[model samples]
Target: MNHYRKIGNILESAMKMVLLTGITGFLGGHLAVALLRAGYKVRGSLRTPSRRDATAQAIEAAGGNISNLEFVELDLTKDAGWNEACTGVDYLMHAASPFVTSMPKDKATLINPAVEGTQRALSTARNAGVTRVVLTSSIAAIVPGRGKAGPPHLDASDWSDPDGHVNAYVESKIRAEKRAWDILQPGTTTTELAVINPGFIVGPLLDSDPGTSGALFQRFFRGEVPMAPQLYLHSVDVRDLANMHVAALTAPAASGTRTIASFGAYSIMDMAECLKKAFPAYREKMPKFQAPDWLIRLYALVDADVRANVRELGYNPSLDEAPGRALLGRPPIPITDGYIATAQSLIERNLV
Candidate 1:
């Protein structure tokens, strides 16, 4: 089937219900909006029931129809509602996972929740007979842990080595994604799985909260980061990322595969330039020069968070964009637009 027709058929099937985890998050909120707008009934999971109304408001503000949206209290660390939430769900969008820029003091704090959560979501979805599952993983799971001298270009075959110089967050994503694959091995269950390894995701926020990716721009705008680190990221807009997630649910080629969602690698200085061009008023605040490796090392000595990601300095890798282009059926949103939208959202919400 053609791309539009396939998506049209899925959208027209109003009976199809999607159980979406992490509906309150940056990507989750976008996914909920996309799923709802596409005519799927969404039952979003949340750790705190009180956030449901606010999350719904955020989704609604982002142009999602909440009439078909509902909420269930679920926790990654506990098994309180896994089976119950999975029951009667046609597809599972497992997007809920711990994410943080700063490394926790203990690695287990992040790793345990991420690994165990994927285990719970996949196991319960299989038991509940969900047709397919689309997991939201990160390029962090694909591109890190390899030394700075690793391959210039990375694809689905690449995996971040947990034993390498990866931090807690990268290790958690690697382990969690691995656990997901381990659970859904062929012959083990009828449920098919597709994983999306997206690069740095940035776009307009649905709410006032500046998520981990949004915080990148937040720091930049607020002059918290005076010097741009010698870092580069393969980037994507959250809207495209959300659509890619939904498309994976029905894309035949997506089954049993990891599709990358990134435009290309862009450096910290590149982002600063983009922002400076878009918002000339903020040009004075933008980092004029990239920090040298030795300066970054010295800064890390004073900041534990910087120390955690010290290994990432000067590391850059090209990501294969063919899978993303095929799945998206178009080029991903321009990286400059993604950067500008993020900054604009933060400014509009008074988050900066």
Candidate 2:
């Protein structure tokens, strides 16, 4: 076969292979579904082999090929086990990170794993000739929300200083993503990089394993939280976030851009009100109170999650979400869709 014909044939059979590092994560799980629907074979990794069964179930739920999905027990803190996972994968999505609310006494718990794990994943991909890599970074990496609201602007170029964050999770993500971006070697056809910076991701769980963000939204629906907070966020649905990640995998224009995706910014009362409107059943079930700033700070002292998240309540914040337009062909799922869907999901799962 001639060069062009041979290249086309190789591409056809390359399986459109992708390696998803956090297949069990909220976004990763959805991404596996998107990739499967688009005809790509996916391989995922966890810290242990035993986690494979859950990942398999997720792929199956998405109507994917359990046979097409493979899992590896890999550690982010060390280089071992990475090469095996990166082998023959066409792209890599580094979604694994230690999610937590409190600042660690030893920063290494969050920092070490996220930083080292990203290095190992990227090192392996570069060595393995992977074509593209998309990192599942949070807006937390871009906006740590430590103290000040911000200087009024930040984009792909902004960096969340490690010294400025109050929560370990934010610090870890900032440190990790910065470390990943700093990695470089002059070579073409090696692994090119992209980053997806999403705000609070919420949605229905495909299974019983509700993610951290999903579970928090559940509290709002259960009316367990009699009062909401001043907390506002420019959040996106987990499903929409997944689609953007897949788009980045092959979009040549996306190679170096950090696409900031958020459906719209809304607050605790605003979200509950949305649930009240879309899912009327939740109107009575959802919390109607909005916690005052003083009470939130008081609650933050004893509640670790509240304390770490206190920074999120400092002011009313919004996003310049229109920048992602060039990368998306259609508008993303609305932020409130996840809130309504969460209540429905809990009902469907009998978890309510």
Candidate 3:
């Protein structure tokens, strides 16, 4: 058995419990399924219990038991109700956040909860005697954007200053992740923290609701993208990303470390071109034109999200995925596989 697998099995003998926030969200849904399959009981945090139907269906569809997953309604913005949620949980994967296409009224609205929520949860988890916490930091936390020459050499050592003038979501994730790592106290086992940062995550949707990344894939299949954006982002399969989270949680080796989980970056043109070649019949539908830099800039003026996305354009962000790949001990699911999987899901459901 693998080091982490052995650890998980040992944990299962006890009443081992893991708390995963945002279990209804895309990343959380993926993590919940993976963790449950590994035999550890999962306690997922939800903003409210009313939304359980959709999440339950998602777990059921993924072959996870609805009964194996438990929900605790909690709020990240407030200091109330965290103690019960964190009580007796063995590990934590803090995955909740306000990731949206629009900006928040106050940057702090997003940043404060991101920072504060982690503090609240970790504090409660510490008091409850949980030994390890794994945070779902993003590649956004690793590399926010590039300078005039392009992205700096990205490694575990690099951290994008989200509090700076980058996108609000970038800032949100940076603050949330930093708060998770800020754990420190005299004689505390819960102070042990690990973070998993993934890149532009893409894969088949666990549910019918299209994700932010899946929406981008939707555009490709709908023949609406018409052209490709000249941007490159490190892509990771959602399954690989979920596996990394489980690994970070149970692996003794991953304790007290932050790791980036991504395979590599590819251009939108490259994705469209790859789609064309992969599904030769779809070649005519794939966009042949590349959106020029100036046009992207022009669109940014009228659209804030466009402004944010345009900021990431014309730059190639390639992170060091070697650690994650080596840690997994396998080749990651190809970006092409994710594209096909997501595209096929939309096609099967008439979403496109």
Give each model a TM-score: 0.96, 0.88, 0.90
Q: List the residue pairs that clash in candidate 2.
A: 76-117, 228-291
Per-residue alpha-carbon lDDT of model 1 for 1-352, expressed as tens digits?
5667656856564778999999989999999998987788999999999998999999998899899999999999999989999888999999999987778888899999999999999999998999999999999999876666778888899898988888999999999999999988766789999999998999989998899998889778877777888888889999999989988988889989999999867889899999989989888888878889899899899999888777777778888899889998776788889999999998888887
Which 10 successive residues of model 2 have the least lDDT summed?
1-10
TM-score winner: 1
What is the clash count for each candidate, in the order shown? 0, 2, 0
Q: Which tens-of-lDDT digit does each residue in 1-352 have in candidate 3?
A: 4677556554652466888888988888999988887777888888978888889788879977667788888888876668887777788788887677578667776777778887888878777778777877888887765643665468888888765548778888887777666663324554578778888788878888787787776777667778776878788889889888877776666777778888878888888887777667667777878899888889889978767767677676567777788656567898888877877777677776
lDDT of each: 0.89, 0.76, 0.77
Q: Which stretches of candidate 3 lie over 4 Å from their true place?
A: 1-14, 184-190, 278-286
Ranking by TM-score: 1, 3, 2
User: What C-alpha lDDT, on a 0 to 100 scale, does residue 128 get in candidate 1?
Assistant: 91
Worst 10 residues of 1 by lDDT: 5-14
* Candidate 3 lDDT for residue 266: 84
In candidate 3, residue 56 scores what lDDT?
79
Clashing pairs in 1: none
lDDT, residue 45, candidate 3: 85
